[model samples]
Target: MVKEQKKRFVLDTNVLLHEPLAIYSFKEHDVVIPMTVLEELDQIKDRKKDVSRDARVAIRTLENCVGDAPPDLLLQGVPLNHPNAPDESLGKLAIFPDHQVTFANPVNLPGDNNDNRIINAALYLQQQSSEQIVLVTKDINMRLKAKGAGLEKVEDYRTDQLVDDIQFLAKGFCELEGDIWSQVSKVSSEKVGRDTYHTLMRNELEEESFYQNQFVIDQGDDFCAQVKSVNDRQLVLKDLSRDRLMSYHAWGIHPKNIYQGMAMQALMDPEIDMVILTGPAGSGKTLLSLAAALEQVVEQRLYDKVIVTRNTPEIAESIGFLPGTEEEKMAPWLAAVTDTLEVLHKQDESPAGSLQYIMDKANIQFKSINFMRGRSIQNAFVLLDECQNLTPSQLKTIITRMGEGTKLVCSGNLAQIDSTYLTAVTSGLTYIVERFKEFDGSANVYLNGVVRSRLAKFAEQEL
Candidate 1:
């Protein structure tokens, strides 16, 4: 039997910008980089945008891969030296001179567009090579154009995509049908101090999935508990009173629903280092997070201060041009935080004064996500909002900045992702929720309902 020929993948600039080390993802397949893509990367590397850093990293990654090879050898092929790739799985990397490719074919798209040039390069490869020639791009329009321009194959870079669909993403809570006890054959109860814990055999609850810090509630709302620990044989759940959870207040803000109650619990927990809240618009994500931050920072004095930051699409470029301090500049984007504060203090006689008083008392500082790098945030509550637009790499950069005695709360609405390069399934919020589900010190809650208003809820469901 004859062996199958290895495939050749032509990567787009957006793919590299989306993931700098994407070259290593196509194991045993030849990776091709067009000259147009290199030029695009060069142009983007110096921009005052967040993607500029990614562009530079992608360029550096390419340099490290085929930098030492001769120009002739680079056009031919250079063996990729990925440390993790197996000997049989190693592939070659080549820089294709798309500019040199003949554009005589009228079917060939005009060279005026970089995307068209990249597509044409892949088209040329398909005509010249027996191996499968595929175009890998993150841009939807580019993919459509490549396919329409007669490319044999095209695909999105899915090396970092954790879930195939948004529905499959972890919700951090499990709602069992009927009574949860009906599904369990046996359970052993224990009391430690004032807390009640129940240990049940893992096999008994095989139908129901459990993870560390995952909340479990019954459909009847009679029983609610949090998974304290899980092992191969047994699962331990900490009993939580549903009434008490509903009554739990944070900076005078109470949960509107059970989902928010769980989120509030996670936010208020001193043991949990990270809490991720994901939901639809007006679902109390920002409100609950801010309320909890204020409660922890001002009332409880658990942390020294409260730092609120979020990813603003034009922040990298527009921030410098905007007037006032960093906090004032960030005010426009962080209006939701201020709006939530107003809601929290609307009943007060001096709402503006109370907001200011609380802001000073809690030492609430609004920082831009662009400036979060290299700063050691200690003894503070960091509330990262609108994180759905961040890539996995960008999110990692911010998460690493968290120092000791700091609690990080990440809240985002996946349905409302604003980044052109990201989707709900590929979002950094989804990535971390799945990645940290089993971590003992982290908790995640997907606030289910829209509590902002009836009109907002109707819009969320219908529009």
Candidate 2:
């Protein structure tokens, strides 16, 4: 019997920065770290950003993997899944040969940069060994470069992939039988703790499984409601129509569409620790989130205050430096915040100084994402806007800052991500929504309406 040789994977620096634990992802395969990768990691080990933090951590992990061994043992590799190892090990980690080796064919690259150097090492390894040597990276251009250089194997690191495509993610709506309207609207119209109660048939359940806070719409009878509770075949609906809102008005910005109504339902639920909203431009994602925060913080006094955080892509990429205090610097990037505030003020018809007064009295804080690291927030409503621009690691950092009695509402339009490394499927918003879909304390809704302006909707649809 012949046993198949395990593949040897060469990881780019970006993979480690994206996930410090990427070493273990190969799972029983042989992993190789090019010397150039170590040099790059060393160069960026002192960086103050998350990339540097990841580099230092990965270097430490690699050092631990190869602790005090013979020079030959490094190339031979160390067990990743060894029972005697301190961490979980599913594969083995090794360092590529330091000596020269020939590639399959002659090649020339545009530049001798770090990425190209890694590709060169991978090519050399492919020629030296009969087994497969694959170059794994998140950078799209690197893959093309490797392919152009005649590398036989290249792939994106997807061990942590939540869903294959963005379409596979939850859309926040569920359909029921046509006759469900009669049974739900008439029979279970009675109120039960923040929502209406209805017992559905096991046949109605069928193959459809409702998420903890997913919305339900039986448009046959104009039925729009939220799933209050899910118990086997028993389904409870919470009406979020005009009459069922917690108060007559939520910070004077009312939910205009059924999706917005669902947003309000999740936002107002004290039990829901996290809420995700995804939609297109002018879909009221930010407005609904801000309004709900105001309602909870100011009207109901649910939390101590409201803290807003945004990954300002425009600011992060261009200009790089903003002069002045943090709030003043954030103001230019938060036009949406200003606009939402204008709408709220116009609807409330308050005095000229009232908005600022409420903002001050309620302790609303506009914070930059850079300083968000290592801060613990408790009893606050945190809104992370424009989250599509964030990476999976960036989103994880933000979410981990959450403390007790705090609600984190993240909203972003997946169709409008600005990051070069992020897409609709890989954006932080999609990552969180898919990962948290099964949790009982997390809820999400996708809004498709663009009620801000007809022209805006036209642009979203046509342009």
Candidate 3:
């Protein structure tokens, strides 16, 4: 019996930008980087943006793969090692067009487009190679063009996707069994302001293996508590319904919806180092995160300053030559940031001209994602809004920047991704919610309610 030939994968540029180590994802299969894609990466490598940074890293990784290897290896292949895609002998990575192969562009696409060139390279490989050849890209249009050009083997890279289906993603809460409430009341014994809590038997639901800081809410009744701590035969439960956090207003704002209420509880808990709020437009994801951040920074003095950053939309390929510095370039993009602050001020009922002082007192400063690569943030509250557009790799970069005594809130509407490549199931918010499900001090909420205004709610539901 003859053994089957290994498959070949030709990766698109966006896939590399989204995950710098994507070459290793093709297990036991050959990986190909079109020379055109390399040139595109080189064109944007100097920009101060996450995608550009990823492009440079990928270029370096490719170079390292070629280090000390004979010139023939560039056309043949080099071994790759990645823990996530571990198969030591799985496959090899190489640069496509080690010798030029002739191919034509899709008639509808411009000949000068980089995407068409990449697709043409894939076409050459498909015609020349006996093994299966696939074009892996995140761009929907690129996929369409590849298919139209008769390249049947094309797919989006799924290595970073945590879940296969959108419905399979956790909604950040679980329904509690009826008897557990009584069991909860038995071990109940803690108070914070007007709130009451309990510590249930850890073994009571040990088989379920509930995640830390997970909300156990029952719409049928008022029994709501978070898994405060999980130890042998004893699990600490903190009340969510009767907690003082729900009734407390933050910077003259209160949680108007149940989802917002849960978000506030997680934010106010010092034990929780990270909180994620996922919701649609007008669902108050930004407003709730802002209120919680201000309350912690100004009222509780939990942090010295609030660092607010508006991550660039994924559409930008490079930062280019803006006339001003980082902050000045980022200022125009921070309209949403300032608008949220104004709403918080008006909610506070502050007199005219008091809003500016409130903002200065809170010590809010805008930080651009361009310069956030190597900084450590301590004793501060960081808000990354519009995070749905961020790739999983970019999100990881920001999360690693958190230092001691720092809390980060990632707010986004997963349904409204602006990036041409990202989908609801493949977004960074989705990745974090699923990847951190079992980790302690990390909580997430799915806010489906729209409570901003009647008109806004109507648009959200009808439009």
Q: Using lDDT as the measure, which candidate wins?
A: 1
266: Cα error in model 2, Å:
0.8
Clashing pairs in 3: 28-90, 188-198, 202-233, 202-234, 202-235
Count clashing residue pairs per candidate.
0, 2, 5
Question: Candidate 2 has which clashing residue pairs, if any?
Answer: 80-89, 81-89
lDDT of 3 at 292: 82
Q: Local distance difference test, per candidate?
A: 0.91, 0.78, 0.79
lDDT of 2 by residue, 309-358 (tens): 78865654332477777777888777788778777777555655777887
Question: Which one wins by TM-score: 1 or 3?
Answer: 1
List the candidates' TM-scores in order: 0.95, 0.87, 0.85
Q: In model 1, what are the clashing residue pairs, if there are any?
A: none
Candidate 1 TM-score versus the reference? 0.95
lDDT of 3 by residue, 32-60 (tens): 99888898899879864556788898898
